[model samples]
Target: MDFYELVKQRQSTRAFDTERMVDREIIARILEAGRLSPSACNAQPWHFIVVDEPDLKNKVADATSARLLGMNHFTKQAPVHIIVVEEKVNFSSGIGGLVKDKHFAFLDIGIATAHICLAAESEGLGSCILGWFKESKVKELLNIPKNKRVVLDIIIGYAAQPLREKRRKSSEEVISFNTYQ
Candidate 1:
């Protein structure tokens, strides 16, 4: 599919076929898309943890109850979960440090996650960007160090049903001509 078509087709999938498993090759392709995303000064301070184990998925679901996304329960239905983590570093002190901006790391990670989502969609997979977990609890469960922060979590698998209609605002409503209103 074309880029525009893929963008329109991609939607947040909540219900997935629990019996289906995503192939490693496809998962690798998704990860590759994320890894190739451009970063500020090429810091590349992101790490991905792909979870396919059933027990782990349950634990993640329990940790994610603080946020709601309809009837689509992530920890129970998704056969695969990719947790995106950002490795914090002092870019101001590093060599070739054009990235004096502090929030660039998070921005870069978001871009990477977008790439991953697109790639998964292109491969005929359904995914949802999950950002509702308790960060400290997630870090403890995943054994992430203090230097790294969880940026986002993505659930991927075959959708149990069809994609839902997307709700979005038009460009006319969101875009500005030259300056803020």
Candidate 2:
């Protein structure tokens, strides 16, 4: 698929087919996209933990949803969840971030997240990037080290819902050429 079209096709899929499972090959490709994503100063600074086992996936899904708040309640319907863990950046990337007052690790991870979502879309799978989960619980469940941080959980599956049109700001509102016009 065309890159532009892939970006347009990628959306936060909320409803997913409960029965269909995402193939391992497709998941591998999506992960490959993440692995090859560009990073500052060659610091990858991210690790992905894939959860596809029925019982464990449900437990991770539980960590993501809040019943009273009605947030991410549908995460359990998806067959897979890929947890993104933030890692330390290279020396130069860390120094550059400190000097520039920016978090290069997060920026790099965000780019990887985009690559993952687009890759999933290209593979005919739906995905949702979830950031509002219980991080501590997830780490404990997955045996992640205390020092590492869980950044995001991405759920993937066949979408059960129809495509919804994307609403976005006009190009003029978000874009500015030379001199920030």
TM-score of each: 0.86, 0.97
Poorest 10 consecutive residues by lDDT, candidate 1: 92-101
Residue 73 lDDT in candidate 1? 48
Q: Pairing residues by index, what is the TM-score of model 2? A: 0.97
List the RMSD of every prediction in angstroms.
3.0, 0.9
Error of 1 at 9 (Å): 0.2
In candidate 2, the residue pairs with backbone N, CA or C atoms under 3 Å apart (3 or more residues apart, or in different chains) clash, namely none
